[model samples]
Target: MDLIDFSAIATEHATRLKAIDPLLPPPGELPDDQGVLTAEASGSAALGVLSCEKTPADAPGAQWRALVEHRLDLRLAGPDPGTALGLLLEKWQERLAESGTERGDWETAAVVIRPSRDSTGSGELLRHGFAPVRVVAVRPAERHGRGPRRTPGVAVRTATRKDVGNVVELLLELQHYDAQFGVATVRESTERALTAEVEEVLAKDEPLLWIAEVYGKALGVARVQLPPASDWSKIYVDQSGRPKLGYLTSLNVAEQARGTGVGTALAEHAHQVFDTEGVDLALLHHALANPRSTPFWYAQGYRPLWTYWYRRPAVR
Candidate 1:
């Protein structure tokens, strides 16, 4: 299919998606000259778009590495869309090999899909070996009223140089919890890297690191950062035209303190800080399969905005 055809199909997909999630952003129009693969059948079509980008490695605290990201947009008017999807994937893999991606330079392959309840695309993705990894959730900061009352005896305060050791410990605990979802792995050097990250955040003015403590013993930690001006200004804003995006990067409480009010106190504290900074929207990602996170975040008033599906084929 040509750009004209691709644009028409993409527009239709966007319309259907907006009916489901009104907050969904408009899809970008493809350039006629850009290379995009297309699979066609009688009365049906699928578009495959490929791009390679650098991202943080899978190992906890590892540096950035290259990866291939594929996006499949399907609009099937026929009886079977799965066949079109399968053909798209086959051609996508072939293109990757041709682009030197199969030489083991890329760490992984990722995809993004917005599948509704009756979306056939969901089953097709799983059948092709993709697994859901991260869920991007959003909540109107305006709705984030004063969170639960702060638990007595638990204090939330900014991290200091003296808290680096304790902060690293809490971060490692969080990483272990994340590993249960299979997207992350703990490494021997994680502590060292986490310590450096904590120090950096403490030194920065835009990103605030908060720690929850009881009697001077750290029990939980939360990291909140001001998003880039481009994203904050363009995508999320208030009536006054002020940027209103704050991202909660990581929040975790020690296993021993799970049931206690420590986690709630820490999260509420973060929200208080964001409110004070004039933020009107907050964003975060958690593993869809993480029982602890899935429930806790929803209870905190966040709703799913996007889902990232992942697949790692054996190095050829």
Candidate 2:
């Protein structure tokens, strides 16, 4: 494909996406929207486009402290999707090598793939050392009834400043559980940082912090952010044109509280809050490798919208 043709294709892709959802954020103009690289084939043609952007070291909650992020969008038009993907991967590796001072110097690389209907490039991604790290799961905001019925002893209520310490502890416990799946590490600073975050949330009236208690002792915590008029709110709306959006940022239950219906109660309560606030959709992300979270969220009716594939080369 020539430069002009490639640019038109990229623009068309973005336009189609926006048309699907007018609120969708614009896919920023790529630096190399004009074809920087092309693939030769045995019988057909393929095109590969790569875009790089610098990611700040202190970007909040980033998985890695990478200096740059490379995004690869591969389009193949041939009978052999596998071969075309292989060619794209080869070109991607060459670009990475040329851009970095040495192999594995870059902190992180990623690609976004839709795996709902097809598995076209999944194998190629795995073969090239990418692992699925985060899955964006979403569900319509229809009421799932008030709260967990089975757990009669558990009570859910809005958290207060006095509950900050307990909430922080529950969050740390969650981090420890997440660490088992290699999603996060519980550092010494984690507690202090989390404490501050909880305190701040408690101070805010918009994003709610809820606690699940049994006999007046906190055993679970859930944080839900009401949609603000900004980018984060628009990202998770249901295609059915939800008037409002709600994000279930974090839900953590104490180890002993698992399987006892505490999590269900907490989640249902959050949903009730969303329903009361006129939210028509809810969104959350969980590590694909988290065995407990994976099933629990699916049971709650959340399905994956996008899967984030991550690659971090081992540094010296």
Tens-place lDDT per residue, model 2, 1-316, is 3323655545554555455544344444445546455554544334566666565443434332245556665544444555656666677777777665356654555453433323556787778887787677776765242223446688888898889889988988887777665346455556767777788888966548888998888999998888583237564443445467788889998998787789988888887887898877777878788888888888887777566676655211
Q: Could you estimate the TM-score for every candidate?
A: 0.81, 0.78
Clashing pairs in 1: none
lDDT of 1: 0.66
Local distance difference test values of all predictions, in order: 0.66, 0.66
Superposed Cα RMSD, model 2? 4.3
User: Which residue runs of candidate 1 sit more than 4 Å off their true CA positions?
Assistant: 1-4, 31-34, 56-83, 97-106, 113-120, 144-152, 187-189, 205-207, 227-243, 314-316
Query: Which segments of candidate 2 are over 4 A away from where they belong?
Result: 1-4, 7-31, 34-59, 62-70, 73-82, 101-118, 143-149, 205-207, 229-233, 236-243, 314-316
Please write out the lDDT profile of model 1 over residues 79-133, one tens digit for every residue: 4555666677677767666766554433455554453322656676777677777
Note the clash tally of each candidate: 0, 0
